[model samples]
Target: MIETPGILLTILSFMLVIGPLVFVHEMGHYLAGRIFGIKADAFAIGFGREIAGFTDRRGTRWKFGWLPLGGYVKFAGDMTPASEPSAEWLALPAEERQRTFQSKPVWQRAIVVAAGPVVNFVVAIVILAGFALAYGDVRMPPVIGATVPGSAAALAGLQQGDRVTALGGRSVETFDDMARYARIRAGERTRIDVLRDGRLVSRDVVIGTELQRDRFGNEYRIGRLGIAGGKPIVVRVGLLEAPAVAVKRTGEIVSMMVETLGQVISGRRSVKELGGPLSIAKVSGEQMSLGLDAYVFLIALVSINLGFINLLPVPMLDGGHLLFYAIEAVRRKPVGPDVQEWAYRGGLAAILALMLLVTFNDLGNFGLWKNLAGLIG
Candidate 1:
């Protein structure tokens, strides 16, 4: 039912964006398993029927599946793609048992499970650094170039030449830092510290709210500081410095994600913001249209999200495996298979419900139901 001429572009963009990321994630687990001397039964990209495949010398089946959403590395003792242990795993010969994943030490298993997310974070940081090196960094100082006549900045006695030093106790190193802090607290009162004409002055300002709309017909209430920038000074850093800057940027992003999640959980943010694969496809297509740089940045952002989401303490995920390992380490024995099975079932149900909700949100985002209703009317 996708009638847009750009549908093909969307599909291609989705594949390009997700394919490498999923491959990287699974490869992390594959490499770690090999390093720990655990035997892998299969190293597969995607799920369902295999389109093409080959058996490696080590007896592992490496293949590409028909579906292209996600991938997995199935270790020898894994009963399913979720990496649960099977009866067959326990029934293996004593010699063969040594090579199975479950036969490995708990620490080894934890490392293998944790590697996927760790690699994802590393890859994102590297890619971001590369981009920073290529594009150069924006060196805009946090000085006020101008202020709206009737806006918050003017009300707060912020002059055009005043240099913003800090906001709400956080130091501002760049215009980005000021903008980031300002955008989240519409109509909230905060203290701004500035250097004006060789003197330091502190002023109280109430963040102003403005309604903004996107091309997709979505409207957002965003905080407006009413301060404008003149020109940004661009400086390209050495390769060594790029990685450090990239690490800082990545950490900032992760921090923001954690804060947003906490806000959502505590009822300060709306659940409607959660997205699924459909939303990703839409964004991927949008980024593709914006050119290669945007698309690459999008990939980096999604990669970070993937890595962080996998680390959440939910069963059937990498973090779930680590959680179980933690309990085993504490109690000196693994939880009963029945308990693990029930927990996995509950996790699967929660995941499915969340997927459905996000898919519904995607439909709403696309205006599918709204358009359909309009047509019917």
Candidate 2:
């Protein structure tokens, strides 16, 4: 049976988690544009027909849309959601044009476009840093307590009490570090370095893969070295050091994301494993039920994902705008409107197709497809 959080709670949690992130993302663009004296026409929390709004003293209309999917900041002289320039607005008098986004220099335009995703990363770092400040760090040594029989480690001749020093040419300091390294190297031949009885030993092994199910019955395929940690150690973090720790944690998470994408592209993983807004809602509800701490951690994770996705070089995304800016910087002029319009259309179609695919995956995960098939039969 498919178990899920109550529908009411799911909707509430989805809004609670997504709304602020969207606001923060758009706010990044707004602030960056303001810095360059670019006037915003509107700052909206969502798309489509506005539900409620007010014009700020600066003449920027602040509005909330009925749909809670995503948001945008409409700057003066922007003709499309992609933030393409409008020729009519660009043709305004010098005094009037000075306050429009198209009037800004290319460098300023790049920063304004990049600020949205960059702010998402900054927000993620802040949330993660808060956790580090509160919980401290685990200082587990990379000592192998035992190896599973017939598993990759044992098959490679790994033994108990071996102090793991490195994996795949990278230094591994602690058990957690080794686990992290192993998690990404599944099914790959790797060189593992260890100190065996005070002597250096190296083993070449093909890391094993495992399909594991969580309490929620969610299946995940992960890498495994089949070796357990020796013991536990924990250390408190200083106030000055927590941010640095969080930064490192953020970098690791980004690395994992990049690796996962590479795995998917290389056909080592399936695209069906990808999640969408529906998945976000389900996970949000589940995490919220776990507790506030769990929910907050989810927020940080989703923040990083949002930042990373926006940085992709797909049209209609922040990175696409930056790509255009880079081209303009090189060509000494902006791309033609006809070319930009076609690119935006392609981007929108790609985004929609992806949404449909992930939504299909979500339904499969919820067993909805099976249920419908049973009914039809």
Candidate 3:
């Protein structure tokens, strides 16, 4: 079992990870709604009971909620208590429905709904770029630092100080390239070109797999070449390069997100890999233990995940609303309320089921169930 400090660290990690991400996501909605001339009823950080609040001149109630899980922005005429109508609202007496959301154009509405995810993506990009610029990208160069004795590299006559020049005839520029090539060829012998003692040499090296574990007891299989590499060399960049770096980082993260989703859908990744609040809390705690930089990185990563997940065309999510907008745009009418309600219910059910499943996985992974079984035994 993890010690008390470890457990506490995990909890703090989740809060740090989820709080800022959720805040930024909700802020996107609030800001977009405001910009599009849609009156916001409330701009909230967190949910449930209001802990702190103040009404703006525009009549938008900005507040912090008691529960810190997530947040929402209530717009005027949103069909629910969450929004007020902009048209009918304005048609009313001067004092009556002054700032309703329904008065906004469809384009405005779409932008308001889309803003939440957009903001999250923007936050992710900024975080990634800022981190990259501040720290300089530390990547493993193709140079080998150490070779494991009696391992595949040793058996293949690969030695320390050898630089990986190419893999499978493809030139390797960085450690990431070499690692990716090796991972794809896991359990298979592959041709590797190395610069050894200033001479280019080719060798057939078989990648071996080993079981790796996290401090939290999570285990996974990783391909190993029994060679260690150096840390990333940080390079400072000017303002001009920052934006490009940010875009590239965002693209890389998006690619990773898509690939991970594909793996999960294809059953190459376990559904047990899905994490819920508990898992997030555990991670948050761990990140807190590692200090601020790691915690910030985790927050950025989770922000990206939240943005990506919400953009999925699943009902009851921001993406689901956007899907409805797309349909409405095509049909020149809004989706019927009955259909929307039913779809929302279905989405809710699916989300709840997923939550339960992920929570169960978290418990099992945390050894809570095992401990319970031991107690009974």
- Best-fitting candidate, measured by TM-score? 2
Cα lDDT, all candidates = 0.87, 0.88, 0.76
* Regions of candidate 2 where Cα sits further than 4 Å from its true position: 1-3, 68-70, 81-85, 184-186, 197-199
C-alpha RMSD values across all candidates: 3.0, 2.1, 4.8
| Per-residue lDDT of candidate 2, residues 261-313 (tens digit) | 88788987788888898899989998898799999999999999999999988
Q: Specify the poorest-scoring 10-residue window by lDDT in model 3.
A: 81-90
Compose the digit string of candidate 3's lDDT tens values, residues 1-377.
64334665565567667877888788888888767666777888888889899998988888888877667777766765223234555567654343455655567777887888898888877887888778766566899887888766787888778999997788888877777655534466778899988899998888887776766556766667777777667668766787787777677677667866776788766787777888778777776676788878877788888888898888888888888878878988878777877888898899999889999998987799999999999
In candidate 1, stretches whose alpha carbon ends up further than 4 angstroms from where it belongs are 1-5, 80-87, 161-163, 187-191, 195-204, 214-221, 375-377
For candidate 2, list the clashing residue pairs, or say none.
Answer: none
Question: Which pairs clash (backbone N, Cα, C closer than 3 Å) in model 1?
Answer: none
Models sorted by lDDT, best on top: 2, 1, 3
Quote each prediction's TM-score: 0.89, 0.93, 0.78
Predicted candidate 1 versus true structure: per-residue lDDT over 6-70, tens digit per residue = 88899889988888898899899999999988888998888889999999899999888998766
lDDT of 2 at 41: 94
Candidate 1 lDDT trough over 10 residues, lowest sum: 1-10
Better of 1 and 2 by TM-score: 2
